[model samples]
Target: MKYRSRTDIFASILQSANSNKGVGITTIMYKSFLSHYQLKKYLSIMLENDLIKLEEDEHLYRITEKGLRFLQLFSNINELIDTTKEYNV
Candidate 1:
């Protein structure tokens, strides 16, 4: 796999969380291709930034509305960039 930028890793974690109702740390780690240590670091930032929430009752993580918006905006930007790349040829 290509080296993923921090933004790419963040997006991947969010996508994995959004893919399910509520997922555990291990689930996100595997889906995001992150190691436990890396995931812990990212999850800490995500929680602090309100991008994701940990549900203690279920021992799971869920994406927040802010995170969803972030994903949508990121997707829009990527689409625009890809469009430009296509035209650059």
Candidate 2:
């Protein structure tokens, strides 16, 4: 995937995680087109910032409320751009 797709991948993953459903890092890595090292680095930062939580039992991850709020803000920004594009203004 192109590098820009990384943003969309993150938004999708965070939306999924917002459901409080756990997700696997492998899946995220694959979908985001990120290498293990890159994913690990970003994951570490997100974890440290309390944006995501890990489930020890299943080795899964979920987004925290802060993450969800951030994702929502991103979505709103995307919507604005999409709407502007439609207007061709």
Best by TM-score: 1
In angstroms, give how far residue 28 of model 1 lies from its true place: 0.6
Candidate 2 overall lDDT versus native: 0.74
Tens-place lDDT per residue, model 1, 1-88, is: 8688888899999999995579999999999999999999999999999999999999999999999998998899898776434353
lDDT of residue 47 for candidate 1? 96
Instruction: Evaluate residue 69 in candidate 2 and report its C-alpha lDDT on the 0 to 100 scale.
Output: 82
Candidate 1 total steric clashes = 0
Clash pairs detected, candidate 1: none
Give the runs in model 2 whose Cα sits over 4 Å from its true position.
5-13, 16-19, 83-89
Model 2 C-alpha lDDT per residue in residues 1-89, reported as the tens digit of each score? 33455556567556655645688888777765677787887788778878788998989988998888879888898877864344544
